[model samples]
Target: MDYDGILNRKPFSTAKDEKKLMYGEWLTELTDYHRKHCHSYGQLLKHLMIPEHSHMGEEEIPMLPVGLFKDMDLISIPGNKVFKTMTSSGTKGQTVSRIYLDRDTANYQQRALANIGGDFWGEERLPLLVLDSPDVLKNRNLFSARGAGILGFSIFSSRICYGLDQDMNLDTERIQQFLDRYTGKRILIFGFTYIIWKYFYQALAKSVQKLDLSEGILIHGGGFKKLEDQSVSAHEFKERIREVSSIKEIHNYYGMAEQTGSIYMECPKGHLHASLYSDIITRRGKDFSVCSHGEKGIIQVLSPLALSYPGHSILTEDEGIILGEDDCPCGRLGKYFKVLGRIHQAEIRGCSDTYDG
Candidate 1:
């Protein structure tokens, strides 16, 4: 599928009424496609098949989280295109987002994000300092998220600052020295969440040491799971990022290696909203079914552009809510949802465990 084309073919966001129609049509198509190709999901369609039902239903497909990845390889592409494979960072033998692509598929993901990133920054391209390295851009076997998923999305620009440290440590000297040499440059510093919090935040905050960076933006996607033990709330984490970089905008987005082009970013209003290519609904939640604003529930992501994998209409483990379904005062249009936490095994959705999904 021309994944990027599917996303940018039309205007992404729409009025609430229009979005409903759009989502309905998308869900129908996704369900039909999954029913045809996904072997395990096909079994689900048969089991949940209803009499007189000629089309796919929104609630019929059996939702499987990362647990399923431990058992089998869920892929739709030919084996020859399997550029690389990855593993779930959870317990051993867990499910991971298996990524495969040719140059077009790879470039599609990058162009989509770059278009959006360019739209947000109001620039054709910004100098990006990747928290990882050019190794991620190499052809050798590495984690797909590192090699293709993250780095691939960043290929639209040529001004890329790379990390040379093998230990993944943010070399303060390397970064500052580069910034000092290349002043008055607009940069987009990208990194995993806790990776920045662990390595860069304190160092930057140590006296509010501002670099010569003229205009820099931060886009981090590495989930907070790595720092689950470090005790950092999303707000405090952003605050820390602001405290260190002093950048007005620091977007903590939520995305997976599976769904290549669809991702949700935290708006300036502090709510993470679904992108145009994706939709999120709360099926069940605490105290009641979280069906509206201020209601927290399990987040189910629906991405129409997920033609490469089975993440088309995935119900993730993250617990979230549809904060609002309209244009925010912040001016971002689309569905808004905040990720409260993840739903852990055997734990009730509202049991108040620290992290589950």
Candidate 2:
């Protein structure tokens, strides 16, 4: 679907009309491809009486309930061609979504991640400090979403250091060593939100000694429901981290294992933005109709990269408000929105939520 061509374009620079037209054509093609190859998805389409020659706008496209992934092994590719299998971090005793990818699709995912991440990290690799224990990465093939996140971003690492020791305690000496060795260099810090807060930030607050991370770019995501339960807002999260570590640049991304690699990244102005290859739609909870800017509703994410599976148009359990399109104060094109949080008990999913008991 000319994924490379789409990913290579400026992430935040496409015109609204042009990008919409492009996404409509490609997404419609993907709808047909999945309908032909994936039996379960085809049944879903047929049951809904969606015609074979349906010419629907991107907003009118059918959306699968993301929970379907947990209940079925939905893949468009043959078993032997399945390159990798990724599982979502569903709550205990609950089912996790399994996403299948062929080699080409896997490579496309990585390239898409690299392109979007490049917007923030720039062209060069930086010294990376991961906020979790090294043990999480021991299994090279199987991964919890947290582990996959570390490995994905590690592609931009010149050198990598794990911040927590094996016991899930902050490894002061190890982290200090990395900072001391790469003193004054611009480093990248990655971790799930709660881990960075409970293990990293809380540890720093308790310690008499402080380490300087002033020259670092801290990127974290997963879910913030746990934090919200504790009365911590994103603003408070960033402010607390700054107070303890002196790191001014903190970016929080919104992504899921169901739609890996096609993340919505938070910009300088605190809004999560869609890149060139993907888009987001906020739909009214009552009718599933598209919502206007500033109206809160369920989130339906659209990505061309999900064609390998039946996930091209997924109605996620998340709720958010579409702030604007193509005219952010941060100057990024496409939709910019704020995640209001999860809808009910949607299984504490995402990378950060993986560690919860």
Best by TM-score: 2
**Could you estimate the TM-score for every candidate?**
0.82, 0.97
Per-residue lDDT, model 2, residue 288, is 89
The digit string of per-residue lDDT tens for model 1 on 1-357 reads 445445564334566666666666666665666567667666755786632225444444345554454455666566776655543334333334455554454455555666566556654666677766455455555454545445654654557667446655556677776677557766777876755665567556675455544367777775676565578777788776775666666887777666666667777787776656666777674532436667677776666665544566666677776777776766777877777667765222211111121
Worst 10 residues of 1 by lDDT: 348-357
TM-score of 2: 0.97
C-alpha displacement of 198 in model 2, angstroms?
1.2
Q: At residue 33, what lDDT does model 1 achieve?
A: 69
Candidate 1 at 112: error in angstroms? 2.9
Q: Which clashing pairs does model 1 show?
A: 342-356, 342-357, 343-356, 343-357, 344-356
lDDT of 1 at 191: 70
